[model samples]
Target: MTPGIPGFRHARLPGADGVQLSTAIGGSGSPVVLLHGFPQTHLMWRHVAARLATEHTVICPDLRGYGASDKPAATSPDVYAKRAMAADVVSLVAALGHDRFALVGHDRGALVAFRAGLDHPETVTHLGVLDVVPTLDMWNVLHGVSAAVGYHLFLMAQPPGLPETMIANSADVFFGSFLDAWACDPAAIPDGVRAAYLRASAAAVPSIVADYRASAGIDVAHDQADFDAGSQFAMPVTVVQQDWGAQLGYDAAQVWRAWAPDLDHRLTRAGHFMAEEAPDEIAEAIRELLAR
Candidate 1:
C-alpha cells in the first residue's frame, strides 16, 4: 500500500471540468493548498504538510494527470496547461469549502500556483513557489551549456509520440533519474517513498509528457500574454529555491520579481526536492509567508 501523510484523510475531490483530484486533507483553521512537482506526487509534501497542519488546514492534491488524480486525455493543448491545472486547484478548493486559500507549489506545481495567483488573485491570500521561474522566464534564461541541466524539459517538451515512447520504454530509469539526481540527500526520500514516486510516474507517462508539451507551447503563450499585460501577483509571495541563477547565468530573484512585486525571494542550500530534504526550513518559510 502507498504511504500517505499520517494524519491526513484521503478523498477524490472534484476539480475543473469533472476531473477528480486525489487529495489528502488534514488539520483546521485557514486553508493552505500544497501542490507537488514533476515526477512526484502530493506525497512529496508529506513532511511540510504535517508541520503546517498543526495550525492550518493543509490540502495536498495530486495535480490532474498525475498520481491517483484523474488522467484526462490531453485532446487539446489547454488540457494539461498550467492554466487548466490552476483552475483545477481553484475548483478543488471551492469544493472543499474554501473561497480563498494560501497556495504553494514546487517545480511544475509552482508554475500552476504562479498562474493561480495571476488568474485568481482574489482567491489566493498568499503564494509560495519553490525552485522554478515562470515558464516564459525559464525558456528565456536557459541557453548554451547551462541549458544542459534541463535536458528532461527539452526531451519531454517534444511533440508527443517520441517522448512518450522513449520514456515509457524505460520508465523506471527515466522517473528514478530525477528522484535520485534532484535530491541533495538520497535518504531524505525513504526507500518506500522513492518506490512509490517511480511507480506513480511510470503509470502516467503520456499525460506527463502532455503536461510538459503544454509548457513549451500554450503555457508559454499564456505567460507571455500576462507578462505583456504587466500582470503581477497581488498577494504576499514567497519563493524558496537553490541558487540556480548562479549556475544558469541569470538572477533568479530578479526574474521572479518581474511577476511578483510583493515577493520575498529566498536562496536555500537545499536540493531541488527541498520540501523533502529540508522540511523544517520549508515549513518555516511558509509560516513566514502566511504571517505576511
Candidate 2:
C-alpha cells in the first residue's frame, strides 16, 4: 500500500488541458493548497498538511509528470513549463470548489506558485515559497565553481534524448542522491518514505527531465518577460530558506524582495528539504503567513 497523509482522502482530479493530478485532500474551512517538490509527491506534505488541516482545508497534489499524476509526453516546451503547471494548480483548486486559496510550494513547485502569484494574482490570496528563488534569479545567481551544487539542473536542461537516457540508466542513484544530500537530518525520511520517493521518481524519469528542461528554456523566457515588465506578486508573501546566498555569493532576501515587495524573508537552519526536516517550524511559518 502507498504511504499517504494520515487523515487525507486521495483522488485523481482533472488539471489543466484535461490532465489528471493525483491529489490528497483533508480538513475544512478556508482552503490552502500545497505543491510538492521534485523527487517526491503529495506525500511530502503529510506532516505539514495534517497540522494545517486542523483549521484550513488543505489540498496536496502531485504535480503533472510527478508521482502518480499523469505524465503527458513533452511534445512541446510549454507542456512542462511552469506557466502550464501553474495553470494546473489553478484548475485543480477551481475543480475542488475553491476560486481563491493560499498557495505554498517547495523547490520546483515553488517556481509554479511564484508564477501563479504573478499570472493569477486574484486567485492566490497568500503565497509561501520554501527553499528556492524565482527561476530567473536562480539562473542568474549561479556562476563559476559554486554552481557545481546545481549540476543536475544543467544536466537535465540538455536536449530530450541524452538526459532521459542517462538518468533512466541509473535512476535510483540520480534521484536518491538529491534526497540524501539535501536533507540535513537523514532520519527525517524513513526507509518506507524513501523507497516510495525512489519508486515514483524512477518511473517518471522522462517527464521529470522534461520538467527541468523547460526550466532552462521556456521557464526562463517566461520569467524574463515578467521581470522585464516589472511584475510583482500582489499578495502577502512568506519565504523560508536556508542561507544559501552566503555560500553562493548573493543576497537571498534581496533577490526575493525584488519580486515580492511585501515579503517576509526568513533564513532557516534546515537543509533544502526543509518541509520534512523541520515540519513544526514549517507549519508554524505557514500559520503566520495565513494570519497576515
Stretches off by above 4 angstroms in model 2 are none
lDDT of each: 0.94, 0.94
- True-vs-predicted CA distance for residue 141, candidate 2, Å: 0.7
TM-score of each: 0.99, 0.99
Query: Across residues 18-75, which tens digit of lDDT does each residue of candidate 1 receive?
Result: 9999999999989999999988999999999999999999999999999999999999
lDDT of 2 by residue, 152-220 (tens): 999999987999999999999999999999999999899999999999999999999999999999999
TM-score of predicted structure 2: 0.99
List all candidate RMSDs to the true structure: 0.8, 0.8
* Pairs that clash in candidate 1: none
Candidate 1 at residue 175, lDDT? 91
List the lowest-lDDT window of 10 residues for candidate 1.
243-252
